[model samples]
Target chain A: MSIPVLTPNIAAALAADVYDTIEMPAGAEFTPATGVLKTFFDFSRQGGAIHGRSGGLLFRRDSGFAVIGKGKSLTPYANSIAIAFRGTQTGYDWLSNTNTRTVTIENQTQAHKGFYELFKSMRPAMEQQLNPLLRNNAHAIVHCAGHSLGGALAQLAAIWIKKFYGNKVALYTFGAPRVGLKNFALQAPGSVDATYRCIHGDDPVPLAPVWPYYHAPYNGQVVRLTADTGIRVSSHKMRKVPHCYQNSARGDWANLISRERLQRQVFLKREDHHKVTFSEYWMNQIWDALTTLLRQSGGASAFVFGLQGLGAGVHSFYDNLAIELEKSGMNQQHSVHLEGLLACMLAFAGKRVIRAIELTARFIRWVFRQVLSVLDRAVRQAIQQVK
Target chain B: MWHLQRSTLVCILVGLLALFTHNPAEAGMFGWFKRIDVQVSPEIKGAITLHDKPQADMVIKRGTFFEDSWSWDSTRTDADGHFYFAEKTVKAREVLHERQVAVRLLALDYPTKGDEDLFFRLSSSHNLKSRSSDLLTDGMHCELSAEYTMSYLKSLEYPNMDWHGFQSKCRFLHADKVIVSQAELDAAELEETWRGIHSLLAYITQNASEMDTDDFIRFHVRSSAESGLAMLHKIRELETDIDKLNTLPNFEKKFQHYLNKLNKEDQR
Candidate 1:
C-alpha cells in the first residue's frame, strides 16, 4: 500500500500526453517534473456548472485541479505517491469558514470537504478506470492545486487519501488555511516528505487566524510570493469579475509558479530525476490523466469564458483584441464573420446622427482655426498699407 | 417616400432593441464618492499628533451596495504622523439617503498598553459601544484602558535563571497591588498582561538596538519629562542600563561624551 515513486522521463512523458489532449484557451503552459508543474484550469463561462454553484462561490471553485507525483523514491518504483490541495482567496467569505459542521458562517465550508469526500469515495472508481493503464505500475502520487478554496480542498483530499491508503499519501498545497486542529499535520504519514504549503507575501487568507499554522509542527515549505500588483486601480473602479480570480492574471499564482520553478532548479539534485521508474511514471500519468479530465470537462472551459468576459468588461482593449485574434487563428471562418459583422455595425453607426454631430463639432473647430489665421494676415496687411 | 419612411422606422426600432439587449443598466454620467479618515498613533510620550489632515475616501454609484464601494482617495500621514480628511462633497444625489452608517477603520493601534504609574486611553469619535454594557454605561462606548509595567528581565535574551527569578518577583508585585480584598487577576488576564509587557519590552529592545547612545538618552529624558513619579522611577532604572554601558571599554568614550554634551546644554 506504499505510494510509488516516479522517474523524470516517465513523469515528463505523462505530462506531455496530458497537455496534448487538454484544451486550455488561456494559453497557460505546463512545465512538469521540474519540482513544479503548472496547468491552467479555464472555467470562465461554463455557467458556473463545475461546482453546481454560481455567483461569488463560482469564483471560489472556478480555477482548481489536482497534481499527482511520487515522493522521495529509493528506486522511483518504491517511492510513495503524494497529493496536496490549495486554499481559498484571502478575504473571501467561503474561505473564512473553518468549522466542520454548519456553524455561524457565510458560505458552506463543507462543500469543499464534500468535494474531497466525493473524490475519495470515487477513488476506487478512479482506480478502476486507471488500473488497466496502471495495474502493473508503481505507487500513485496525487496532488490538488488551487489558489484560494481549491488550495483548502487539495489539503483536505491529501489528508483523506492518506487515511484511506495509509502511509502512501502526502499533501502539497499553497495559501491553504488550517482546516483542522494542529494535530492534523501530525496525523499525516510521510507528512514531512509529502507536504509542502507555500504562501505569497501578505496574502490575507494565510494571515487570518494566523496562529494555527504558526504554532503547528508541520514540516511543509512555506513560500512568500510578491504581493504588489504593479498596476494600481481604485477599489471603487474595481468590479468583481464573476469568479474571485483577478481580472488580470498578474498576481500570486504567476509569482508562485516562477519562484517554485527557480527553487526546484536551485535545490533539487539531478540524481533525483534518474531515480524514477517506469511503473512510477505510468502511475503519475494516470494521476495526470485524472487531473486533465477534471480540468478539461469543467475547469478550463469555465476559465476561458470567465477570462474573456473579464477582458471585455475591464476595457482591457489589448487583452480583448488578443483573445479575439487567438480565437480567429483557431477558427478562421467564424472570426472573419465576427469581424465583418462588427465592421458593418461600426459603419452604420458612423453614418447616423451621433456621428454627424461629432463630425460637425470637428469641422467647426477647424473652420474657427482657419478664420483666426486669416484675420491675423489681414491685420498685418492693413498695417503695411497704412505705412 | 412612404416605403423609405417605413424602412427608416424599422431600422430605428431594431437599433433601440440592440441597445437595450447589449446593456440593461445604462452607465451613469455622474459618479458618487465618499471619504473616510482613520487615525492611529501610540499614546506614548513624544508621539506627536498633528492636525494636518490626510484624506481617505471610497467611491460608489448612488444605488450600489456599501460593501461594493471603492477607495477613490487615500492620503499618507504628515510629518507628525497625523492624517486629515478634507471636506468632500459627493456629486451623486442618490447615495445620500442613508443615515447612521457604520465606518470601520483599520487602525494600527487598536489596543494600547502602559505601566502601573502611567495609563493609556483610546478615544474615537465613532462612539463605539461595548458589547458588555447596556443601560449603565451610556457614553462609555468601546474605550479600552489598560495599565501595565514592562521589564526586559523576563525576555529570552536573559538567562533562564534570571528570567525565572524576575518573573517570580513580578508575580509577587502584581499580587501585592490588588486593591480589592477578594479581587484577583485570572490566568487569562495574567497571560494577557504578560503578552502586553512582552510586546512593549520587545519594542524598547528593538528601538534601543537601532538608536544612537545620545538618542537613547534623549528618549529616556523625554519619557521622564512626561511621566508621573512611578514612571520617573522606572525611567531612572532604565537610565542605569545606559550607565552600565560605561563599564564596556569600547562604549565608555561615546557614553561619557554624550553625557558631557547634555550637561553643557543644561548649564547653558
Candidate 2:
C-alpha cells in the first residue's frame, strides 16, 4: 500500500484550518475539515499552568485536535490521522517560550525545556484521543502540523508518534522557533519519514533561540517563500499578505523552491564583517562561523551537551565562546574575525563598538542580549497583529 | 408665426444648455433619464445603553453614503434612551450602487470628567437597491461593552471574487449580511476606487498605442500619491489627538517612495 504525499498547498491550507479549532466556540461542531481531512474533532483548551520547576504536568483542558479521515482522493490506507496544535495564546505560553533551558527527553534527546513541558501538559489528552483512533486503524499515516510556537510542540508530538506508534509520520511546521540542540536535530530523519519546514524569508521567529539550538531535519532545507530580504513585523503574519507564509505557500510542492543547506563554511574577512548588512544570510553565516570556532577549540561537546540544563549555562556558553576566540592558539585570524562578528552584531542592534575595548564575557553577553532584544520586540509586535 | 419662432428659439437654447452642462466624455449625456429615486436607508428604531441602563440626552449621528456622496443627520435619544430614524430616499443615477449607513453614539462625561469618547457604532452596507431584510433585526440594541464584530460580503462589481468590503458589526443575528464602521467601509471603497482607476489607466494605455508606458505609469503614480496625501491630511484634520496623527505624514512618505520604486522597476 502506498502512502499519500502531502503537497505544499494542502499542507498550507491544513495548517490554517487547524486555527479554526482555536477560534470557534468550544463544544461547537466544527465545519468539515479541509484538504484530506473529512471529519473533525476538537480538543482545544485555554488554560494550563507551566510546571517548569517540577516535572509533573497538569492542565485544565486540552489545547489541540485530531482529524481522522481518508488520504488525498484515493489511498490504500484505511485511515489517515492529521493532528494539529494551536499556537501561543496565554501569558504562560510566552513565559514558557522565553524559558529556553534544555531538558533531556527519552532516547537522550535534549529538547527545549519550555517546549517539552508544553508537550507534556497536552501529551495525556493527545494520547487519550489518538490511541483509540489508531487502535482501530493500525496502518494510519500520521501527519502532524502547526505554526508559531505550536510548531515546536508539533515537532515533539511527531517524534513521539513515530517512536511509540511505529507509524509513518510526517511533520509540517511554519515559522516555528528552534526546538532542540544538535543531537535532537540529527534524529529527525531516523524518526519522521518526511518533514516540510516552511518559512517566509523575512520571518524573525524562526531565527530565535539562537546558536547551540537548531531546527531539524538538520540539513537546513527550507521551502523559501518569497525573496524578501530584511526582517519586517508584517512578514511574520500568517494571513493573505503577499510575503506571508500563508500567501507564499499557495502552489504545489513540486513547483515550490527550496533553499539547500550552505555546503561550504563561510569565513568572514575584516572588510566583510565591518560592512555587514543585516540579513538572514549574514546571520546564518556568522553563527556557522562561531560554531566552527567553538568546534576547533576541541570543547564543542562540553559546550553543547554538557551545559544542557544548568541555570547559568547560557551565560557560561557565551563567555566560554568569547574566551575560546580570545585564545591565541585558537587562531590568530579567528580572533580578528571574532571582533568583526561582534561589531556587525552590535551594528544590527543599532550600536557601534570599539575594538580597543576588552572582549570580556560581559560585553559579549550584552551584545547577544541587545540582538535578542530586537528580535524579541519584533516577535511581540508580530504576535499582536495575529488577530 | 412669431409665437412658433419664439418656441423654437427656446427649445434650441435648452438643448445648448444641456449639451454644455452634461459632457458625454464625463457624465452621461442623458443622465436625467437614467436617474432613479431609491430607499437607501431603512427606518430604524434603536435604544442606546451603558451597562444595560438607558443612556438619556445623548446625541447620535447617522451618516448615509449613496450615489458616491455622503449626507449627515443627527438625532437625540429621549428620556427613555430610544431614538428613531425614518427611511431615507435618495436619487441614484445607477440602479446598481452601494449604500452605506452608520450611527455614531458618543458617550461623554462618563467614566471620567471631560473625556469624550464614542461608545457604540452600528454600520451596514449593501449594493442592490432593495434592502436586506435582516439588516436591523429586532431593531438595534447597542451595548457599549460588547465586542465589535466585522463581516465580509461579496463584491458588487466582481461577485465571483471572495472577501470584498461592506462588513457590519452590529450585535445581532444575520449581521454578516452588512458592514461594520463607516471609516472601514470608506477605506474598502477607496481600495475599489483605486482598482477602478488602475483599470481605466490600463484601458487607456491599451487603446492609445502611441502612449509611452513609462510616462503613463509615472503620471498615474504621481497622481495617486497626491490624492493619497490629500486623503491623509483630511483624516488628520478629523483626528482629535495630535500625537496619534504624527504617523500619518511618515506613512504617506513611505507610500509615495514605494510607488516611485515600483515605477522604476516597471521602467526596467
Candidate 3:
C-alpha cells in the first residue's frame, strides 16, 4: 500500500479549522472582523510554511481591519466572515527563494496627489466592515491563522488593528516575523498588549528583518518547543532530528502542543504581560557605556567620534543583547556592565591613536605659547635700549 | 661682573641646546621672509591717455597771480607706473574696458604724532607707455592725486560682486549721469534675480525626493528657463542703460549692443 499525499484542499481545510474553532460572537459583522483577523492569518500561513508548521493562529481586535492587505482594496460583504488559507509550499518557496530585487526611480512632485487617491479607495470597504461592529461599542475579538506567508501577514494586520482600535484588540502571532519599522513597534496601540510572537528557535522564518533592531511587540515569556525532525533541505539530505521539529508526522503534533502551551501562557499571564519591557529598552546602557569609554580615553572630542562609529553596529549589538537578557532574565545592571566592557574592547585600538595625537598637540602648543611670551619681552627690552 | 658673565655663558649654552633639540626652522635660507612682486599686464596698449585742458584762473593766493591749468584724464596708472590705452581715439569709442592694472607701493610715509601716526601720506605714481595700435586711446584731462589713485586700487581689490562691477561697466558705456544713478539703484536688483535662480536650484536638489516624476521633470524645465531669463534681463538692462549715456563713444555703444543681442539669442 502507498502512503497518501495531503491534498491542497485537505491541507487548507485543516488550516481553516484552526480558525473555525474560535467562536465569533452573535450579531458580529464578519467582514471587518475577518479583515482584521485576515492579517494574522496571512502572516501565519506565510510563517507556518517557512517553519513547516501545520498552521498558525493570529488574534487581534476589529479596528485595524483596513491595514491587513498589501493591496489598496478590501474584500466586500458586510458581516460575512472570510477565512483564506494558502498552502505552505508556496509560502516556503517565497521566503526561501532569495532572488528578489528592488529598483528605485526618481519621484516627481505631482505623484503625491495620486498616492492620496489610492489611499482613499480603500476607505469604503474598511468603513463598511468597521462601522457595524464599532457602532454597538461591543468588544470585538478577531482571530486569524495560517501556515507560512499567513504568519507574517498576521503580524502586520495585528499592528494595524492595534493602531486603529487602541485597547479594543489583542494580537497573537506564531512564528511571525518582526513587523513594522522601529517607530511603529514603539508607538503601536496599547490594545495590542496581548500581542505575542512565539518563535521555535531553529525555525528560520521568524528571524526575518521585520523589526530586527527595535523592540518587538512580544518581549517576554515566549514558550519554547522541541520538535523531532530536523529541517529538510531536500528529501535526500535528511539527518537525525534537530533540536526543534521540522515538518514530520510527529512534528505536527509537537507544533500543536507547543502552540497550546503558548496560548495558555498568554491567557494566564495576559494581565501582567504588559509590564514586560522590550529587550532593546536598554539603549541607554549602550549609550552610557560609550560615553564613559570616551571620557576615560580622550575627552569630549574622542567621545563624539567614537559615538559616530558605534552607529548601526552598536544598535544591533544592543538589540541582540537585550533579547539575550530577556531570555535569561538576567540582571540588567550586569548586562550593562558587560556592554560597557564590550564597547571598551571595540574602541580600545582607535582610542590609543586619538590620545597620542591630542597629547602631542597639547605639549607643542604649551611650549609655543611660552616661547612667544619670552620673545615679546626680549624684543621690548631691545627697543627700549635702542631708544 | 665675573659671576654675571658666567651666568650669561651658562644661559647661552642652555639656549643653544634647546634650539638644537627643537630645530624649529628646519628649512635653511629663505625661510624667514616671503617674496612678492606686482606687475601689470594688458590685453591691449595705449588704453589710457591724459586729458589736458586750459583753465581760466579762478583765485589768487593773497596778492600772487595764480592760474589753475591742471587737467585730468580717464587714464589710470598700473602698479609699475604704466598707463596703457584701450583705443586709438577716445572720441570715437563710446566706452573702454578698464584693463586690470596692478599697482604696488614703492614706499609709505608716516608722520609721527604724540603717540599717534597721521593717516595721510604721499606715494609716487608711474605710467607705462603702450606701443600697440589697439592700446591707443584719446587723452582725457585729469589730475592724478595720490589719494585718488589709492582709492581706485582699493575699490578694484574689493569690488562688490554685484553693484560695483555692474555700476563700473555701466559707467564705462553710458557715461550718462542719469544712467550712472540708475546703475547704482538697480545693481542689487540683478543680484537678487541671480539669488532667486540659485535658490530655486538648491530647493529642487534638497527636496527632490518629495517630488513625483512629473513634478520633478517640470521643476527642472522651469528652473532652467527662469535662470536663463534672469541672466538675459540683467545684461540687457545694463546694455540699454549704457546706450542712454551721452559721454560714451559710438564704438562702445555698438559693441555693447552686439553683446546684448548675443545674450538674448542665447537665452532663447
Among these predictions, the greatest lDDT belongs to 2
Model 1 alpha-carbon drift over 4 Å, by segment: A1-92, A97-140, A166-170, A189-192, A209-221, A225-387, B1-268
Q: Give each candidate's interface RMSD in Å.
A: 31.8, 25.5, 38.5
| Residue B41, candidate 2: alpha-carbon lDDT | 55
True contacts kept of 3: 0.00
- The lDDT per prediction is 0.28, 0.54, 0.27
TM-score of each: 0.25, 0.56, 0.24
Off by over 4 Å in 3: A1-134, A165-167, A210-215, A227-387, B1-268
Residue A290 CA error for candidate 3 (Å)?
A: 12
Q: What stretches of model 2 exceed 4 Å from their correct place? A: A23-28, A32-78, A92-98, A240-243, A257-259, A298-302, A305-316, A323-331, A355-357, A385-387, B1-268
Q: Chain B TM-score of all predictions, in order? A: 0.18, 0.42, 0.22
lDDT, candidate 3, at A38: 33
Better structure of 2 and 3 per TM-score: 2
Provide C-alpha RMSD values for all models, in order.
30.1, 25.5, 34.4
**Cα RMSD (Å) between model 2 and the true structure?**
25.5
